[model samples]
Target: MDQLLSTDMDLSSAETDQRIHDLSGQKQSGLAWVKANVKEINDWVDRDGFALLRGLNIVSTNQFSTILETIFGEQLSQYIYRSSPRTALRNNIYTTTEYHADQVILQHNENAYSNCWPMRMGFFCVVPAKTGGDTPLADSREVYKQLPEALRNRFEERGIMYVRNYGDIDLPWQEVFQTQSRDDVEAYCWKNDIQCEWFNDGRLQTRQFRPAVMTHPQTGEKVWFNQAHLFHCSAVDTEMPDSIGADYLPRNAYYGDGGEIAKQDIDVINQVYRDLTFSYPWQRNDILLLDNMLYTHGRQAYTGTRKVLVGMAKAAR
Candidate 1:
């Protein structure tokens, strides 16, 4: 593969350019190249939180899966707790958030609201959108730094509580757990530290308590790790107020003790995310790898067709 080089300075700084590593015009392609440079690529990702590989030959889901396997080893994590609409392509590869073209997906760490989450995640851009559709990234470390002292202290002490009411209006319980049996879903939730209750109408309501800030296992850096802003009722108010009522929204967030998270606080958190976010237009054939604990990612609104496949691995305890 082409020699990877850092394109910018501190990744956490908003003043710096997006970190990208050119992997085009390489001497080797596919598994061979990935196997040889696995350590190097991982080191870059560790230091920068994310790396964008350009000019690779990956075009299909199979090829992307092969590359992911080479980097993350044979076993990869499954999308157990489905939050967004996605179509599974093949072999654990799924289409990136299947939301409407006009919708914006706020920045979040993959599965951050859960007790378990992937340590590493990757995205492959198969087809670039004609307009918009940039996969924006933000440094979680910076997010932590940007938060006000009082807010940070409050979050660390209270943690975060995520509440989901799953049914026809949102994602069905069967689909979220990838099982039709309610017993199986309950079992899965029990093992994952999630509390679940079945409503009289057959809807599933669940709640999970997770840390608002966590120390990265490898780097030991403290990062703002929860999805409170993304899951708060205010998010629905901003995005699709006409379509769903705040109480009927698929998910909402609160303090670990079940206290309401103020909308003003959510607004401040969203602003910090927007301020720290670094976005670049998607280029066809580009592959981006991220340390899920260190960086948060989001999707921008688009006008035309956009095909991006995603895969995750290395589950964090």
Candidate 2:
């Protein structure tokens, strides 16, 4: 086990390479070192919400899966209600968001818009991008504290409603549910508290109401946790032409009562994320472990190829 490093400690005066924990030396000891130090690692993550484990020399998806299993002590969670494309490398190991390298992914907790979500997640960087592509991490606790009192109160009171219209242009219902059978998808939706409807045109629509804030099961700390900004109409408006109406967008979010979320509020939330996010360039074989309820993660646009593998564990409601 290596010494735990605090991200809050001023690193401006220290050499850049000395800032993060380098656990490469522990490779010789293998999982034994991780097993012995699991408590320390968990405590660090609980305090910081995220930890960067660098230089483990993890080469393949199989190795990544093994390492994650050792840490999580269980099988990884299946990615249900997918928003981005990803290919499963093995049973649970997956390539992180298969979007274009030039696309910027906004910060959000994994599956925050859904009824159930993973309690923790890990990202293994196998290949570093030519430039940019740093995964930004933001403390959800800070996001909650920084949010305006009125907006936070309103969101906590009403919760959030996510609506999706699945079709060819966006992710199809089959792909999103990871099942070709409509009955299976419907069953999943029903079990997950999602309302599903089918259209005559072979389209599928679903609506779900989820909390905007959640108390961490282990720590019992309230954190801002929702994908309102990512699913808002303003997000679609920024990418698509003006001809597309908000209602016709692939996905959108509103208050739990189906009331509109103002664009200004969304902008404020985004700005707060930008102000609070902490980011670092990915180093090959660097692994990031996150307390999903306490932290949010996002991808920055890059110029070249970047391969980051991801896995999640400990599903919680």
Give the per-residue lDDT of model 1 (tens digit) for 207-278: 999999999888788999998987887766455545766565688899999899988898788888878876
lDDT of each: 0.82, 0.81
User: Model 2 misses residue 57 by how many Å?
Assistant: 2.7
**Displacement of the residue 288 alpha carbon in candidate 2, Å:** 0.5
True-vs-predicted CA distance for residue 192, candidate 1, Å? 0.9
- Per-model root-mean-square deviation over C-alphas: 5.9, 5.3
TM-score of 2: 0.91
lDDT of model 1 at position 159: 96
Q: How far out, in Å, is residue 126 in model 1?
A: 0.3
Query: What's model 2's lDDT at 42?
Result: 71
